[model samples]
Target: MKAKQIRLATRPNGMPTYETFKWTEETVADPAQGEVVLKSLYASVDPYMRGRMNDRKSYVEPYEVGEVIAGGVIAEVVMTNSTQFEVGDIVIGNLGWATHQIAHEDSLRKIDPSKGPLTNHLGILGMPGITAYFGLLDIGKPAAGETVVVSGAAGAVGTVVGQIAKIVGAKVVGIAGTEEKISYLKHELQFDEVVNYKSENFQEELKAACADGVDVYYDNVGGTVSDAVLRLINKYARIPVCGQIALYNLEKPDLGVRVQPNLLVNSALMKGFIVSDYGAHFEEAITDLAKWLKEGKLQSKETVLEGFEKLPEAFLGLFKGDNIGKYLVKIAEPSE
Candidate 1:
């Protein structure tokens, strides 16, 4: 059978264009013993993928030119040789940018569609969800009644981080870029306050919003907004540096905002972490996330694209902050 795949055609300097990728379909032998043929259902588009597009040293290695771009995907087993899974079973794994994947059964984690939407497995219950869980709880360590601030508050990781902080009894304030997103965070998600970073007086507004000062800053966008937030952090405040999407497109890293010296005066704690680094604690985090999700204490959103061919467009949207939540590409319909 043949499978469609998107491969890196060239390394992108800033914002990637369609020319940077080439999509093609190729035939491959059927699954080998202990392997399954999976039909991808959804693919996640994350900020980290931008780093992988460059040939640079990062928490993860960059994707080589002429290679298939990798990412988390939700799929269904259409054929299997392993006793661990059978035909029509749903699963999630790092299946890259292909409509079909052939791999050992162990490479996929069986998922129960009855638990929730299959797409949730790629969003709230997936890597982005896990990142928010550990990044906020382990790194930020918010206390009850303490003021917690989150940048990129409407994005996948940021939304979860802010809501989780509220569940833990912290006064949550969110920073997003649009009026619609700001309204959603305040009215729908119930954040204590929502600030539009694009506003003319964003800095002054942030100060007025957090009258008591911020105890924990869950930073997803690191630029001028973060620089302003840093000025208001309480002594010994914690900053969990989950991402720097604001500067991901910069050709020179030095041109990005500088925030180190502020940490010195406030005696603050700032740390950069990769969610994969806390793999051993994933079960614990997921257990809590699932409970909160079921109990209505947590909420998730996804901006989905209809076909696998739109993957590049969906990915480029991340850098422009055009997506409202977890950006996902639906490659195929899920099995009933």
Candidate 2:
């Protein structure tokens, strides 16, 4: 089979553009013993992938200049030389940008199509859902009747964080970019309040939304938005620094409002974490998330772009704030 892969052509100086990616076609090698020939069903586009584009050491190593861009993918076992999986098995893994690829059996985990739609593996049942699960519950530790504020509140992880706070009996206030996102966060997700950071009186609205002050702040976007949220946090507030999408494209470190004084005055506890930090408990988190999903206590939303060729467009849309929840590309469906 021939597969097309997107490679990093040039590291972005500011925001990534078409020039940053290069596509190449190649004949896929047959899977060796203990391996499987996989065809991608869907691929995930996430904000964290932006940091991997730059030449810097982070929680994960940066992608090589000419290497294939790889992240989470849901795929079908097209052909298998391994006893671990059959030809029709659905699996999920950290795979390449190619539509079809080869992977060792150990690198992929089978997904039961009976539990949910296959796209769930790329969203709620996958990394983003798992990230929200641990980041909010373990680190943020929201308690009942507490005021829980989430930044980037309508995106994948942020949306789940806000909904989970509601499940924990906390008053949920979500900060998003647009009125549409605010409506989805408030009306659809049932958040107690939703504030648009793009509004003229953003800080004032946020303050009014959290009259009791913030107890658990799930931060997905940092920089000035964080500065505002930090000012309203109550004493002993818990902050989980999940993502700093605001600073991802910047050429240099941001030197804006110093929040150390806010932390000091409020006696707040803030910690930065990569989702892999809780790898040992992923199954536990997924189990609970799946239960909540099945019970209708949670909803997984995604903006899916069709065709593998549109993957770049779908990815670039993340920085543009074009997606409401998880953003992904549906390359193809399994050939059943």
Candidate 3:
């Protein structure tokens, strides 16, 4: 079988561009024993993938300059030699930018589509959801009647953080870029308050929204936005640094207000975490999230683009804040 994959053409200085990627086709060998050929159904494009594009040492190794860029993918088995999987079974794994892939059965988890849309496996029920669950519950630790504020509150992870805070009886406030995103967070998600960080009076608005003072701050976007939120933390506040999307594309170092003084004076606890930190408890978190989703207590939204060719475009849109909830690309459908 033939598959086209996206590859890194060059290391990105900051925000990646069309010139940063190259597309190529490869011949996929037939599945060997214990292996399967997968047709990509849906795949996710996230902010973390941006970090991988940079030639830097981080939690994960950088994507090799000439190899295929890989991430979360939901696929269907087209051919299988393993008894554990059937020809038509849907599966999930850390796969490639290609439309099809060959993988060992152990590498993929069978998906039960009855739980939700298969795309959910790449979104609300996948990495972004897990990231929100642990980062907010374990780190932010919002309590009833306390104030919880999330920057990038309209994003995939940020939206879920706010909803979960409300579930735990916290007053949820969200800071986002556009009025539309702000409206979705406030009106659709029922967030207690929403602030437009791009507004001229952003600091004032956030101050007024958090009049009771922030008890838990979920920092998805660092840099200036985080700087503003840090200034308003109450004594013993909790800040979980999820991702600094604002700083990911920087071509140069961003020097700004030092945060040590703020953390020192407020006696706040600030920690950075990746979702895998709670891998042992993923089942517990996913079960709870699934329950809430089934009961309509939790809602998920997504910006889905069609076709394999749109993968790069979809990823580029993430930094521009083009999507609501989770962003995904639908590559193909199962023949079965």
Candidate 4:
């Protein structure tokens, strides 16, 4: 079968443009023993992918120039030589940006559609949801009645973080870029306070909204936004550092306000972590997230762009704050 893949054409010094991606079409090889041929149904676009574009050492290896960009993908098995799966089995894996590709049985996890929507595997039930789960609960640990603030609060991770905080009985405060996001967080997600970071009086509004002081700060977008949140932290505040989308595209290093002093003075716990750090506890997190979702204690939102060709645009939309929640590209409908 002919398959299409998107490769990294060039690495960008700052924000990536259309020139960064190179599209190619090639024939897919037949599945070998213990392998399955996958037809992608959906793909995830996240802020963390920005760090992988650079040729630098990170928790995960960088995507080499001219190599296919890989991330969480939900697909349906079209052909299989593996005993573990049969044709029409839906699976999720860290696969390439291809319409179809071959993957080993061990590398793919079959999806139980009874749990939730297939797209949930790429969003709330998958990476972004699991990310918010461990980061906020394990690290931040927001207690009942305590104030929890989340930056980029309307995006994938941030939205889940805020909802989870509310589930635990915390007063959730969200900081997003647009009015639509602010309204959604405040009205739909029931966040106690939602501040627009782009507002001219952002710091003032944030201060007013977080009048009780922040007990837990889920830092997703670092930079001046974090600088302000740090100032309002209460004694013994907990901070879980997730993504730094604000500084990811900068050509030069951001010399923002040093965070050490606030952490020192407030006796705050600030730790940065990637989702893989808690790989051993993924099942635990997923179970709780799935339960909350089923109970209506947690809400999942997605911004989907139709077609495989929209992958790059959906990815770039993440940095532009064009999405209200998880951004996804729907490539095709499952043949089953």
Candidate 5:
């Protein structure tokens, strides 16, 4: 069968545009004894995938120019030679941007749709949720009644961070760009305080909202936004550096306020981490998240763009802050 794919056309110098991706068609090879043919169902677009576009050394290898761009994907087993899976079984994995492909059984995890929507596997109960769990619980250990501030508080990981913080009894304050997002975070998500970072009085607003000082800072967007939040750290505060979305697209270094003094005066602990850092504890984290979701203690919101061709657009929109909660692209539905 012929499959469509999105590949990295070139290493982006700044913000990646549509031109940065190349779409092509290829014939999928038949499955071998241990493999199965996968029909794409849903694909996830995240801020971290942008980091992979650049040709630099990081936790994960950079995407080669002219190679398929791969990330978390939900797919259905269309043809299988493996006993672990049968045709029409839905699964999730680190798959390519292609509409169809062949993968070994070990590379995929079968999904239990009864637990939640299939899309949730790529959002709340998947990478983003797990990232929020470890980053907040393991690093920014928020105590009851303490102030917890999260930048990029409306995005995939940020939303989860704020919700999980509230679950732990912390007072949650969210920093976002648009008024709509601010409203949603404040009213819908029940955040204690929501500040619009794009407002002229952002610093003033944030200071007022976090008058008691920030005990836990979930830094998803690094840059001026993070600079503002870092200034309000309480003594012995903990900061979990998750994503630097604002700085990811910069062609040159972004020099801002020095943060060492803030850390020094407060004797705070600041650490950077990728979700994979807590891979060993994913099962536990997922169990807790799923339980919260089932009990209505946790809510998930997703912005989905239909069609496989919209993958690049959905991804580029992340830098533009075009989504709230989790952003996903629905490629196809499972036949089963």
Candidate 6:
């Protein structure tokens, strides 16, 4: 059989362009023993993928030029050789930007579409969800009635981070790029306060919204926005540095604003975390998140792109803050 795939054609200097990727079709072999062939249903586009574009040493290796881009995918088994799975079983796995992939039985996890939208397996119910869960609870540690602030609040991880803070009884405030997104955060997500960082008086507005001082600041888009929030953090406050989207595409470090002295004066605690570091708690977090979702305490939003060819476009939008909630690409239909 033949499968269509998107491959990295070159290393991007800053923002990736269409020339950076090349789409090709190739013949795929059938599944061997203990392996299955998956027809992809949904693929995730996340900020972390940007880090993987550059050929540099990091926690995860970068995608080599001329190689397929790696990402989380929801797929259906069309052929299998393992007793653990059968044809027609829907599963989630770390497959790349491809229309079809072959994986070992152990590489896939069964999915229940009845639990929620199957695409969510690549969004809220997936790695981004786990990132928000562990980053907020374990690192931020919001206390009841305390204030929790999140940057990139309209994006996937930030959206869940704010809602989860509210679930823990903390007053939540969100910072997003557009007014429409700010409204979504306030009206749809029910955040206590929402600020449009693009506004002229963002710093003043943030201070007014967080009168008591931020107790927990979920730093997703770290830069000047993070610097401003840091200055207002109360004593012993916690900052979970989940992502630095603002700095991801930059060729050099942003200069002119320094907030380290404020942290020193406030005795605040700031920590960086990778969700994979807390893999031991994945099942526990997912179990609780599923319950919250079922009981109406948690909600997820997804900006889905149809077709596998749009993966690069979906990914490029992340740096521009162009997506609300989780950004995902639906590649195929979920099997019954």
Model 1, 1-336: lDDT tens digits are 899999999999887888989988988568888998889999998888888988889888889999899888988888888899999998898877999878788788999877888888888888899999999999999999999999999999988998999999999999998888998899999999999998999999999999999999999999888988998999899999999888888877645456677788889999999998999988898788888999999987889999999999999888777787799999999777
TM-score, every prediction: 0.96, 0.98, 0.98, 0.99, 0.98, 0.97
How would you encode candidate 5's per-residue C-alpha lDDT over 182-239 as one tens digit per residue? 9899889999999999999999999999999999999999999999899888999999
Total backbone clashes of candidate 4, pairs 3 or more residues apart or in separate chains: 0
Q: Residue 323 in candidate 5 has what lDDT?
A: 96
Report the candidate with higher lDDT, 4 versus 6. Answer: 4
lDDT of 6 by residue, 15-75 (tens): 8888888998987797889999889988998888889888889889999989998888888
Candidate 4 global CA lDDT score = 0.93
Clashes of each: 0, 0, 0, 0, 0, 0
lDDT for predicted candidate 6 compared with the true structure? 0.89
RMSD of each: 1.4, 1.0, 1.0, 0.8, 0.9, 1.3
Per-residue lDDT of model 4, residues 107-214, tens digit only: 999899888898888888888999999999999999999999999999999999999999899999999999999999999999999999999999999999998999
Return the clash pairs for model 6, or none: none
In model 4, the worst 10-residue window by lDDT is 116-125
Candidate lDDT scores, in order, read 0.89, 0.92, 0.91, 0.93, 0.93, 0.89
Candidate 6 segments exceeding 4 Å error: none
- Report the Cα lDDT for residue 27, model 3: 93
TM-score-better candidate, 1 vs 6: 6
Those runs of model 5 whose alpha carbons end farther than 4 Å from true positions after fitting are none
Model 3: worst 10 consecutive residues (lDDT sum)? 327-336
